[model samples]
Target: MESMTETEQRATRDQRARFEALARVVTEPLHRYLLRRAEPDQVDDVLSETLLVLWRRIEDVPGLEASGYVSGPAPDPDAVLPWCYGVARGCLANARRADRRRRSLLERLTWTVAGAARETGDADHTALHAALAQLRALDREVVLLWAYEELTPSRIAEVTGLSANAVSIRLHRAKKKLAAQLERKTGPHPGHETDEGQGTATGNGNGRSSR
Candidate 1:
């Protein structure tokens, strides 16, 4: 490969210096945000991607962006960097995009699993599962993405092949339906027994009938 010209070398050094400084301020927060979006186990992968972006586009990284400071003897550059939130947010969006394509087929699978059944005595689990069984397909999928799979809306869209806005809307509606289900579960109707907001009883782990 051709050696970098002196001009390119100087430019690279300056850019590296700026990015070092940016990393000092953002290291902790960036890692924490990634941990939340992905997991502690995946933090390194996400962080690597974030830093790679910073390195590749150091020139594009304005003093106010994610460029690092010159390290060691290089005096702390008295320059304002881009809001760390912006950097982390962009990184998160990129990470989410990367997850989308891989999850496409799996996300297309049927929402309901044959194994999910009502639990006895655990009123909370029973109530929640009952509500899930009552939700519309799209809405239920969004709720499971967040609650069960621990995914953000962007990730959910990648799986569901829906837009982020649409995923958010469906999630909201799903949660509301879940809440309404719980409400009706306690609501008085003939043949339906109210637990009086106490603990409702079920039998065989699947029956809606009171014990």
Candidate 2:
């Protein structure tokens, strides 16, 4: 292998540092987000897919300051984390689609095998799932991103390709709609009321927003 000059070595070190910083910031939260939405067994696989994309596009990971603080005027997390969520969103979607295809193939090949894979039921869980299913895709995403993932509307805007104001409005409306549906189905659980007028920013542990 060719020896790296001093400058080349420094540049390589900086790149690795930036990638590690992003991984440190995103790994746990990203995995949790995937876990909340994905089938339990596929969460790790989907998380691996998300991280693989991150590794492949390390140079393109945004918000890394040259000094490695990964911060700017607004905050490094705001810039970078949303972008990471966007990547994860796509990876999760692809994984789910592939899973469906695989299940379909299995069922076609052997009904007994496929029947054994059926998911177990819970009434509360089923009600929530049904309510969520009733929502339009965008509305469902806004609700899940806010309530389940604890993402702020601005961050969700980055992931869903909506304006911040749009995300806020959609999230607000979706919450009301979901609340109503759930109430009608199974009555309110404790603490079921939506927290209205919450600010658009609820900073995650790292103060990152979704992109």
Candidate 3:
């Protein structure tokens, strides 16, 4: 094998450094993103796949250019996170498709929110999961990206490939629908009591936990 020239060697080092920095900034949020969307068993594999794509496409990440060469400052999260989320979403979809191809229909049907909820035996969690399941797939995704990921409508648009206006509309409608569903399921005061006797589920009126 031929040895790399000095310039090529330097470029390779810079790329590694850049990727390390990017990974540091993105790995935690990306893990949370996957955990919310993927099966527990699949989250690690999907997160690895997502990070592999980020490594290969570091040049495409926004704010990376500003990080400079060789162990520079980390890229701004705001500038790159939406794009990173988009990458994870695609990777997750790919993993899901692959899993569907490998598993029998019976096996796939066993993987469900209701089944998981029953195992947890948490009434609030069960109600939340049931309510979320009622949403159209895309709308549920929008709400998760908003509430779980704490992304704005514009950022969700970047992640979901929808226009900002479309994301906003979906989020608004979905939140209302979720609120109504939770109220029906858990009563008008659809929340748990805190030590102070305050309702913890008064979560932005979106049927999500305020935490």
Candidate 4:
């Protein structure tokens, strides 16, 4: 291979520094995001794919356009994370699609083998998980993004490719649905109310109060 010129070497260094900064800020949150949506076995693989896409498309990450130099300030996590989450979401979907194909084949070949039941580790959240399962996939995703990721509607719009208004509407409806489901499971307490005015709800696990 030909030796890199001084300029090419500097460019390579800058790109590495930028990606390292981006990865440090996103890796944990991205892991949680994928863990919530993907199978335990697939989270690491899908997260690797997501980080690979982020490396390949580093220039497209928001707030990094001006950071071409290694010494420049790191990109803001708030500004960059939503876009990174979007990439992870896409990668997880691709993994799930491939998994479905493999699972279909396995099911055909092992029709006599009993499937294992899914277990939620926390007994407290069993009702919450069951309620989440009852939602339409898109609605459940909207709720997870709002509750677990703690994304604002606009940020969620960035991640999910829905318009901000649509995100707001979906989040509102999903919260009401979730509150109703949880109420039915454990009866309502006086203070346990959905924040309809602010578009928020509470649940036992992985859920956050919205501002």
- Regions of candidate 3 where Cα sits further than 4 Å from its true position: 1-4, 66-71, 104-211
Q: Residues 101-170, candidate 1, lDDT per residue (tens digit)?
A: 3243123221321112212122234455566778888788787677657798999999999999999888
The per-candidate count of clashes, in order, stands at: 15, 5, 0, 0
lDDT of each: 0.59, 0.67, 0.72, 0.72
Cα miss at 193, model 2 (Å)? Answer: 56
| lDDT string, candidate 4, 143-174, tens digits | 66665456889999998899999999887776
Give the candidate order by descending TM-score.
4, 3, 2, 1
Once superposed on the true structure, which residue ranges of model 1 sit more than 4 Å away at CA?
A: 1-4, 62-82, 107-211
Distance from true position, residue 78, model 3, in Å?
A: 0.3
Better of 2 and 4 by lDDT: 4
lDDT of 2 by residue, 78-129 (tens): 7788889999999989987765544443232123222221221221245556
Is candidate 1 or 4 superior in TM-score? 4
Clashing residue pairs in candidate 4, if any?
Answer: none
**Location of the lowest summed lDDT over 10 successive residues in candidate 3:** 105-114
Worst 10 residues of 4 by lDDT: 112-121
